[model samples]
Target: MHDLIASPFLNSFVVLRPGRLEGIALPERRFRELAQSHGSGLAVPLWLTDAARSRWGIDVAPRPVSHAVHIRDAPVYGHSRASWEINLGCDLDCEHCYLGEKRFAGLDAEGKQRLLLILRDAGVLWLQITGGEALINPHFAASCRLAHDLGMMVEVLTNGTRLTSPTILESLTTSRPYRVTVSLYGATAETYDSFTRRRGAFRRVTRGLAAGVEAGLPLRLALIVTAQNAHENDRMRGMADELGIPYKEYTHMSPTIYGGAESLASQSPAHLKALERFTGCNAGHTFLHVDPHGRASMCKVGRDEQIDLMAEGVEGLVRLGAIADRLMLRTGGCSGCRLSGLCSVCRPLAKRYQEAKAPLNTYCQHEQKGDSG
Candidate 1:
C-alpha cells in the first residue's frame, strides 16, 4: 500500500512507498527534489490525495499529481468537498436562524446511507454532518461512522445542547468526528438563553462542550454575532480561551432561506466590509451544502436555486454546477461596475437585491457612493 501524509504547513501531501520516511515538513525545494528522485510520486494537496485514496485506494497511483492542485482553483463536477445537514431539527430556536421555522424531513437511514455511498463514489473526500442539531438526529452517529468507513473525513456542527447525554457521548466517541464545532451564542446563561429562547440551554451547551473536551475530541468554538449578544463577543472569546479551544467569530446574517424577513439588525457597514474582504462563497466550485431533505445548493444563502439530490443522485452535481455558473454571473447594476473589485456583495445577495428591487445602497457601501456604472 502507498503511504501518504498531509502537511498543513506546506498545504501539500507527501507520498511514500512504505518505508520512505525522510521526516515531515520538508522544504519545498527538498520536497521537489525528493519527488524527482523518487520517480513514482509527486507533491499534491492533502484533500486531493485523500480524495483519490478514499475513492480508489492503493490502486490509484500518484501519476500527474499536479492536476490535484487545480481541484481548488477549478473544481471538476462531483469531485469536491461537501457538507450535508443530516437533519435540520435543531433544538435551538435562535432568532437569527437562517432556516427559520421550517420543519425538517430528511431521508431515512437506508436512504441516507445510499446518499453517502453516492457522495463517496462522486469523489467527495471531506464531509460535514451538520443539523438543527446533528446529535439530536437518531441516526447522526451512524451517519458519521458510515462517512468515516467510506474514507471521508467528518466534521460536526452543533449547538452542544444534546452532546452531554451519555448515549450521545458514547456515539460520538465511536463515530470519531475529525472535529466538533460548538456554537457559542453568549458567555453567560442569561444572554445565551435569551438568544435561543430556550431556558437552561446555555448550561447544557457548556456542559456538552466540557464533555467533548473530556472525551479527548478536537473541539472548536464559534461565536454567532447578533444584536442581542454583540456585547458578549469578547466574553465568549474568553470562555473559549478558558476551555483551551480554537475559536472563530462570524457576523454575517441573512434573511431566512424561506424568504422570511424576520429583520434582526445586521452588523455595521465597516464590520461587514472588513469581513467580506476575507470571505467569498465557494458554493458550486469546490464546496456544496446539502439540506436535510437532500436539496443541494452552492451555499446556505444560495439555497433558492437547488438540485434535489435524491431525485438526481450523482447527476445532481452537474445540475448544481450549471446553476452555479448562471448564479455567478454579474447581474443588475453589478454588471460592468468598476467598484466590483472592492464590493463585498456576492451574486446571491445581489440576486436578492434584484428580486426585491432594493437599491444596492442597502448592501454595498460602494453602491451607496454611486459607484455602479
Candidate 2:
C-alpha cells in the first residue's frame, strides 16, 4: 500500500474538449515546439492534482503520437468495442452516474442519424447504447434500426427504468443487436431505489426485461457491485438463473471527480474486494465511446476529449483511433501498476502529473473480474 499512498501524477484527471487532444492541452503536433522553445524539457501543463504536481517537479514534454498508421477505416486491429450514449439525461438518479443529471447530452433524431452513419461507415460493429435512459428517447427505435441497417452489431446498456418493452422488442427483433444489458441495481425496489432515489424502479426494470424477452429482445442483466449491494450478487445471480436470463456483475469503485464524488471514492478495499470486478479500467481506447453529440471518445467513463467524427468525419476518427492506440501503449500510466492485467479499463489510465511524474490513474485500488459465463 506504500506505493498506493505515494504521490501520483494526475494529468489524465484534467478534462478537455474535441480537437483538444484527449483533454490534453498540448496539440498532437506541438510537442516538439515546446522542446525547441523551452531550454530542454517542458511537459504540457494540464494536470490538476496536488500529489501529482509534487511527484514530477518538471514538466517534461510528452511523446506525441507516432503518425505510423494513418489510413482511414483501417483496423488498428485491437480488441475493440464501441459504445454510444444516445442521451446523457436519464430518468433515474443512480449513485454511480458521474454527471448525475447535470451533464445530460441525449442526441436528437438528426444527430442520431448522422451518428449511426458515422459508426456504420467506420465499420464499428460492436456498440453499447446508453443514456439517461435510451428507451426514454423517442429516437430509440430509429437509432437501433439505423445501427442494424448499417450491419453493425449492437449492445444496449440501460437502467431498468425503461426496458424490455413490446416496442423495444420490435426494434431489437434482428441479428444486429445481439444483446441488451439491464442493470440490476438491487433485487428489490427497497434496495434498488435506495441508491437510485426513485421508487417503483426495480419492478419496472424487471417487467421491462420480461417484456423485451417476450418480444424476443436478447436481454441480459448487469449487476453493478456497490457498497450497498455488496452482498447481493448471489441473490441477483440466483434470480437470473431462475428466470433463465444470462447475468453479469461489475464491482464498483470511484475513479471520476464528478457527481456523487464522495460516494464513489469511499468504497473500502475489503468491501470492494468482495464486490468489485477489476481494479482498473480499459474501456477508452479498447472501447470506442460515440456519444449523442456526434463526438467519439475512448470510453464512456472518459467522455471528455472527443474525436469529432462528424466535422472531422470517419477519416478523422480513424486518425484519433491511432492516437488512442498509442496513448494506451503509454508507459506513463499502467507500466508499473499492480492492477495492470485485470485493469482492462481503457479509460485514460496514465496521468501526467504537475511535478512531471505521469502515473496511471490508480484510483481503482481493486478491480472486478468474474467468469460471467
Tens digits of per-residue lDDT for model 1, 156-202:
88899887888878766776666788889999999999988899998
- What ranges in model 1 sit over 4 Å off? 1-78, 266-273, 278-282, 353-362, 367-372
Model 2: CA > 4 A from native: 1-80, 99-102, 174-176, 257-260, 263-268, 274-287, 302-304, 329-347, 350-373
Q: What would you estimate as the lDDT of candidate 1?
A: 0.68
Pairs in clash, predicted candidate 1: 90-132
Model 1 vs. true fold: TM = 0.76
Q: Which 10 consecutive residues of model 2 have the lowest summed lDDT?
A: 1-10
Predicted candidate 2 versus true structure: per-residue lDDT over 1-373, tens digit per residue? 0011101012111212111112223332333333343343333334322222354332222422121101112233332357777877777877665544435555668878887776655546456787768877788888887765554556787775665565766666643356677878777778877867788778887787677666656678887777776667678888788778888676645444231344454243444433234444444434577766878776655444678877887666645555565555536434665655554344352232211231223233332332221
Local distance difference test scores for all models: 0.68, 0.55
The prediction achieving the highest TM-score against the true structure is: 1
